[model samples]
Target: MKIEIPYGDSSETVELADRNVEGVLYPNPVRSGDEQQVLRKAIENPINSPKLEEFLNGKKRILLIVNDATRPTPTARIMEIIYPLLKGKDFKILIATGAHRAPTEEEYDFIFGRLYQEIRDRIVVHDAKKSECISIGKTRHGTEMRLNKLVIESDAIIPIGSVEPHYFAGYTGGRKSFLPGVASYDTITANHRLAISQDAQALRLKGNPVAEEMEDAEALFLKLNIFSIMTVLDSNHKTYAAAAGNLRDSFQALIKKADEVFCVPIKRQAEIVVTVATEPTDIDLYQSQKALDNGKYALKDGGIIILVSACRSGIGSQTFLDLLGSEKSCKAVIEKLNREYKLGYHKAGKMAEIGLRSQMWAVTPLDPETIRKAHMRPFRSVSEALAEAFKEKGPDAKVIFIMDGGLTIPRLT
Candidate 1:
């Protein structure tokens, strides 16, 4: 059988014998339709809140929060529907960059698409390190809640982003657009410290301390008419479903649709797991780490993980790279992380944790030295990596291929 795995702008096909393949994971089938129409309808009819027009009554100076380039949210389509409705009102779009670097002009053009020309002047890139953030108090979890000053000064704040399974914080969208999206560096680090807990794992929400703390942090701004629009995309990255309304309630509605589209069941664990970081997620090492974390769920102890990511932009964040290169051993990294938790550094810790349990080989555009620094062996081709893994584990080793590693969560049945 030939499996086409996502790699950068295109895909690469790897041929494997049928008997050697254990399973190929994919999101459940979803009805295909006009993506724009779905988004428009979702905006007109919100989940549990008033319509956009009704919600904007007598309100001015709207602050719109959008996910940055690393995320796959359809910002252009969303703005096309929202911009005209708030014609006379004062509104501006803020790119929620979190601690990641600001998007370049070309990247912004790509993110906004055709709408770039119309709303380019009104867009503001959030700087987490800037003094423009204002403290609104702290969450019950003791996270200092400092957000973009615009959020506090604006008459209304609307967060827009895609909903997907997150390694921590349960899922993306909703309160996430605030906590780490447009929040200050201190606020981001403080809230991200909760990631060390097991409850912060993907697809879990009920007792997720990270998600709960984020909700509590966002609740601090509820008085400012904070409505949200969250979207869920199909495997092709097209809009599958969307929900709009009160941040938490609307996000809850989107989560149900997201779960149906992203969760996959597996018969058992595999000794060798191969996965790809598909499109937007494959842009850099910082974002691509999610694939390794998710794939770990389907891998047995002492197994090998062959992750295919383009990492065209190299390691996305300097802080992450520094953390990974700082520690000489996985044990030392874990010890440092336990003593002091940093936002981007946690990603390094996670990679180390996975590395300690199982071996990982990555096929990417990154240099071998950089890949080695992250504790992952680098390969120029997936076939070569797989061949070596098979040789090490014997020819009859059980293997599984995940088409979209960053999005699909495999559950053992």
Candidate 2:
């Protein structure tokens, strides 16, 4: 059988004998209707909160927080319904860049689409390092709750994002737009440290320390009228479902929908796993790591995992690359990460953890020298990587191919 996996802007196909293939994991097929219609209906009927006009009627200054370009949320489409309603009201759009670098003009244009020029003047790109952030309070975990002053001062706070399976923090959306999205570097790093905990795994929410702390941080802003508009995207990147209202309630609604769309059950683990970081995720290494983490679940211990990502933006962040380069071994990386947790560096540590358990090979645009520095074997093509893996495990090795690996969570059943 020949299967096509996402690579860079396009896709690449690989041929594997039927006897050698274990199974292919992908999201369940779902019908989302027309994109604009789905969004319109969601806005017209919000969950656990008043209608849009009722919610925004008396507010003087409204602040809209959006996930940065790294995320695949269709912000501009959501804005079409929102921007018109706040025509006369004072509102500002803040990009929740987290600790990553600010988005470029091209990225902003891509994010906003046709509306870029229309609301360009109202947009404010958040700088986690230099931005003026106000400390609200500390969480039970002792994470200093600091956020952008605009978020604190706004009469109304509306965060827009998509809910998906996150490597840690259970899932993305909900309170994430606040912590890592708009929070200070100190707060983001502190909160992200909880990722090392066992509870913080993908498709998990209950008892996840990282997620619990994020919820606690949101509680600090009880006095503020904060509403969230979260969406669920299908494998094709179209809006599958949307929920708007109280942060917790709306987020929970999206989670229920996501579970049905993204969770794939496998009969058993495979000896070799091949996965792809699709589309926007393939744009950089930082975002592409999710594919590796998710694919790990479907691989047997000591097995080889081959990941295909374009990584067109190179290493994505210097901090992540530096952290990977700093340690000589996986143990050394874990020790350094635990001793002093840095924001972007945790990704490197997580990658090292996975690399320690199983051999990892990458087919990406990243330079071979940089790939070696990160302690990963680099390959020029998917076929090249698979050839080596097959040579090591034999031609008839059980294999599994994961499409849109970053978004699909595989479970052994």
Candidate 3:
């Protein structure tokens, strides 16, 4: 069978032999058609629609923060709802990127299209690294939060992000954009630490530390009078559902859909694995760990793992590269990570150990030296890797394949 997988702006096709081996496929998350309808409905819904009268009633200026991606831009949806409401009031929109690098012109064009240049006068793209931030009061747990003064200075703040299942957060939305995207480094560190807490790891909503951390972040944003509008995209990357109006209500409704669409079952254990990293930064030793986490779950002991990525961007995070440099072996890495780093780091290190034990391979356009440092064998192409794996195994070796494993969801065939 031939399968097509996402590779940046286009798709890459791969083939598999009909040998009764298990296969995993991941469709791009953006669903354009559903996105439009959900955005339209959210705009029209009386209870959820952005209230121009209420917003402009006495407010001097409203600030909006949005996500910038190659596709599935929510700016158009936002403009449709807010345009009528902003007739006589002063308002501006900003892109909240958090610690990630800013979007480029090509990316902006892909995501915002004409809107990128059209909204120049009223839109201000925020650079988290360089922005002049002011210290916000500490959270209840004493996590110092530094936020954009412009966000705090505005009469109202609005956060917009696409909701999807997150690796550690369980799902992403609500106060996420504000806390990590718009928040200062200190705030990010504090909240990130919470992900390792027992509460965050608990699957239950009431006791989940992730949930509690989100609640704390949400309360802080709300106290500052921030309004939130989060989008939930279907498999096709279209807005299938939406939550608007106040922070909590909109997020709660969207969370329900996220749980349904994002939860996929994997029987656990495959003889072969294939993974892709879209964000080149994710291929960086630090961010690349996310890809490892997704790819390792279904991988069997001594199984072959293939990572398909073109990491020309180079490993961007110094801390991550340094950590990898210091640890000689996967076992030592895990021990050091658990002893010195937080729980999330420890968990990641453990995952890395599992991946190392497996027969791992990478096919990339990255420098040979860099790939060497990653401590994985390199293949020239996807086909070459699969061919090699087939030859290395026993005559009756079972084969399994995974595509775009980073955002993968297993389906029952």
lDDT of each residue in 331-376, candidate 3, tens digit only: 6765676566632353445345655678667777666655555556
TM-score (all chains, Cα) for each model? 0.96, 0.97, 0.83
Q: Look at candidate 2 and tell me the lDDT of residue 83.
A: 84
Please list the residue runs of candidate 3 whose C-alpha ends up more than 4 Å from where it truly belongs after superposition.
5-13, 27-35, 46-53, 70-73, 194-211, 278-289, 339-359, 391-395, 398-400, 411-413
Cα shift from native, residue 25, model 3 (Å): 2.3
1-413 per-residue lDDT for model 1 (tens digits)? 89887788877778889988999988777995798889988888887788888888888788889988888899888888887887778889899998888888878876888988878888899999984998888888887898899988898888999999999888998888887988899888888787877677899877988888987876786766777899998888889998888888878888888988888889988889998898778879999999998999989999999889998788887777777778887778778888876678778877888888899899998889998888888999888898999999889988989888999899887
Between prediction 2 and prediction 3, the one with superior lDDT is: 2
TM-score of decoy 3: 0.83
lDDT of 1 at 413: 75
Off by over 4 Å in 1: none
lDDT of 2 by residue, 1-413 (tens): 99787787677788889998998888878988899888888878888888888899899889999988888899989988888888888999999989877888988987898999978899998888899999999999988999999998998889999998899988999888998899998888888888887688888878999888988887887767887899999887889998888888888888889988899889999889998888677768888888999999999998998888988788787787788889887778888887876778768878888878898788898889888777788998887788889999998899888888889898888
lDDT of 1: 0.86
Between the candidate structures 1 and 2, which one is better when assessed by lDDT?
Answer: 2
Ten residues in a row with the worst lDDT in model 1?
218-227
Report the CA-based lDDT of candidate 3 relative to the real structure: 0.63
